[model samples]
Target chain A: MLIAKVIGTTISTIKDPTLTGRKLLILRQADIDGVPFGKPYVAVDTLDAGVGDLVLTAHGSSGRQTEITKNRPVDAVIMAVIDHLEISNRVTYRKE
Target chain B: MLIAKVIGTTISTIKDPTLTGRKLLILRQADIDGVPFGKPYVAVDTLDAGVGDLVLTAHGSSGRQTEITKNRPVDAVIMAVIDHLEISNRVTYRKE
Candidate 1:
């Protein structure tokens, strides 16, 4: 799983049939502080995460474990919305 | 799938029991000309690919679709060894 931030949304009309009606979002991996960096990637949004929301994404086959993403060709999925992050006993980030 | 270059090997004494006897290799994504870039990642090597070899890796559940990686907790697999890469009408890279 990766700590990531929902950066934006994707609207695809011609895609795998299994993906019809699915919500795909753009995300970037965030550090422990919830600051996103690196190249952007797309993931299925099972948790209704919106832009600017910090979330946890499960990649690979694990992405398909969700009810909404099962049997789909997509490789990444937003599985959890982060409420806060703690590291070494200190709170690094909290949802606004 | 990603075009990648196998950079090195991994020797692990303790890991998932299912990964016992599996060969893991480090790799970096490569460009159309087979020049590698980006952070390194580890993947199960079923094809005996060596360091500096250009290969194609399957990610997510697709990584587990291979007989050697099936049901394992691994997220990446070197499934194909690239013979060459062609874009448009030109051969960008060929195995040496």
Candidate 2:
């Protein structure tokens, strides 16, 4: 899993039928210091994460393991909302 | 899905039991022109792609959708081997 911040939501009127009713959020990958990096991409939200919320994102088929995404064509999914993150025993980010 | 090239293999003696007997290939993301880009990462192979083979890779939970990867903890999987790739009506790569 990778750390990311939900940036916004995406709505498409015409898309795969399986994607209907799924919450698609824009995610910006974040480094340990909570700084955003890499290109922003769309991710299916499974944990009710909101914009500005730090999330743990699973990529590839693991994104489909969630009940809501099973058998869907999604490639990325938000699996958990991060409360805090630590590296090398040092706290790096704390969700507020 | 994204295009990538298998670069090598990975062996782990200690890993999730579900991952046993699964072939793990290292993949380098490639652009439409077949030029490698971005950081290399590991991906489970479902299509028997070999090192240097151009492949289509699915990320997130979609990687686990394959029969061999179902219920596994993997995040990336190679789903198809490319015979050729075209962009703007021009062939960019053709398997030799």
Candidate 3:
């Protein structure tokens, strides 16, 4: 799973039927220090994560394992919201 | 999905139970012209793709959507073997 920050939401009225009712959020992949990088991509929101929330994103088929996304054609999903992150024995980020 | 090339295989004796019997291959992410970049990662092979084969890889949750990967903890999966790729009316690659 990649650490990312929820930057914005995507509004798509015309899409696959299975994608209906799914909340799409724009995610900017972040480095270990929580710095955002690369181009942002849209992902399905499963944990009610809001913008600015740090999240763990599951991409591809793993994105569809959630109950709401099962058998769907979704490619990316926010699987968990990060309360804190530690790397190399040091705290990098903490929610709140 | 991202385009990649199969470079090698991975052997894991200890892993998630759901990953048993899964074939793991090392994939090098490739650019539009099939030039590899960044570090390589392991992905579950669902399409029987061989080494050097150009494939389309699905990541995260989307990786588990295949029949063999359902409910697995795998983060990447080769979902398709590319027969050809074209961009801007130019043929970039064609399987031989």
Candidate 1 chain B has its poorest 10 consecutive residues by lDDT at B82-91
C-alpha local distance difference test of each model: 0.77, 0.75, 0.74
Q: B-chain TM-score, every candidate?
A: 0.98, 0.95, 0.94
The per-model DockQ list reads: 0.08, 0.11, 0.10
Count clashing pairs, candidate 3: 14
Q: How close is candidate 1 to the true structure, as a TM-score?
A: 0.54
Model 2 chain A worst lDDT run, 10 consecutive residues: A82-91
Once all C-alphas are superposed, what RMSD does model 3 give against the true structure? 9.5
Error of 1 at B16 (Å): 31
Best by lDDT: 1
TM-score for the first chain in candidate 1 comes to: 0.97
| Native A-B contacts reproduced, model 2 | 0.20
A1-96: candidate 3 lDDT, tens digit per residue = 566789999898999988888899999987544567888999888778899987766666766666777788877777556665543345666766
Off by over 4 Å in 2: B1-96
